[model samples]
Target: MEDESGIFARESAYLERYVQLGIASGRVISVSFPAAPEDDAEPDHPLLERVVAYLEGERDDFEDVTVALTVPTAHRTVLEATRAIPYGEQVSVERLARTAGLDADSDDDRNVVRDALASNPAPLLIPDHRVRDGPSAAPPEVEQRLRSLEGL
Candidate 1:
């Protein structure tokens, strides 16, 4: 039987989103990202629900199943920080979530990462952690270089 680990998987398309755009003088800004398609493939990942239920002490049907998530290279600092810690001492998941502006404490985030590790998802396990951190961490010279290369 294939260990569920080390397989590539796509991010869940069922996750919800909220965005706003166009606010003047403290009114607000509204933004429209693409809508998740209704016909998108359903999530087979139950880890999020299971983790929540476990944390809440409401889960009576506990069976081990893995879930997967994708970590984009755009958030590399989190990955590097995570990698710095030995697995036994690693607190990368929470740190990564915080760096990515996601709720690190959320079961959803945790499960997503766990799943990704199990499945060996791309980008999540790729060697591009530097890209993950945002612009503030970029040095002035590097930033100038990146900008110079942008339209080329």
Candidate 2:
């Protein structure tokens, strides 16, 4: 298992539009597009620069980003499977469950996967958006841009 820390720091940027990065315990906790700026706004940092580069398709810098999330044990499998999804690709919940060694056919197990994805704390870093049935925390345009970058 990887130590879920020191991967990225919380940073904000106006890449394409205003976005917020939430990091803690040395790992990214969330990525969101805020409608307004918060009071403690800081200037763009290296992490944001890397994220911008990634979104622009200039580089795959975000691939190295790590995230820290504290969900129930059952959700861990779902998150782990989500993390393994390659950039520019999508997979169904059943496929994800199977990849995570869970019983894909079980309604209860599938629900766990779906719920975990819906509640994903880290979006871009863990990339729950890559899951076909997962909720996307990022703006639809941003998600579309990412997919376009991959020619998906």
Candidate 3:
């Protein structure tokens, strides 16, 4: 795992990716990065493969993956808009509010988008990294990794 410079590089293996994705009713519910290593075998899910590939620097929109919104109805609307953010692109929370048909000028409207991203259950699938401002979808390190992978 050491680079030519002799510094250890972060691994992106399927298991080492260590992104915990939760699902129910055949839909993704949550995605999180834990400090501990995964214990059990990798779950038998096609999206897991795609996610691994994405972590390895592949470009995947993940738009085809279905996710169940755990947020409120209005917040779900913001998440719905979040899903439209293209791969390798970044948008501010205010722009996301406007995309969700919320008044960008209203702090309340922007807050809704912020809150939705903050509580985003399915981070990678929802591509919360594509959204800037307010809360982040993944941890600071993971978020930077994702951005680097996307060349953002």
The TM-score values for the models, in the order shown, are: 0.23, 0.79, 0.84
* Ranking of predictions according to TM-score: 3, 2, 1
lDDT of 2: 0.68
- The deviation in Å at residue 83 for candidate 1 is 7.5
What C-alpha lDDT do the candidate models reach, one value each? 0.31, 0.68, 0.74
Off by over 4 Å in 1: 1-90, 121-152
Candidate 1, residue 51: how far the Cα is off, in Å = 35
lDDT of 1: 0.31
Q: TM-score for model 2?
A: 0.79
lDDT per residue as tens, model 3, 30-145: 77877543564255456666777888777888877777786788899988988899998999988999999999999899888888888888777787888866587678777777
List the lowest-lDDT window of 10 residues for candidate 1: 121-130
C-alpha displacement of 69 in model 2, angstroms?
0.8
Top candidate by lDDT? 3
Measured with C-alpha atoms, the lDDT of residue 140 in candidate 2 is 75
What is the alpha-carbon RMSD of candidate 3 to the true structure? 8.6
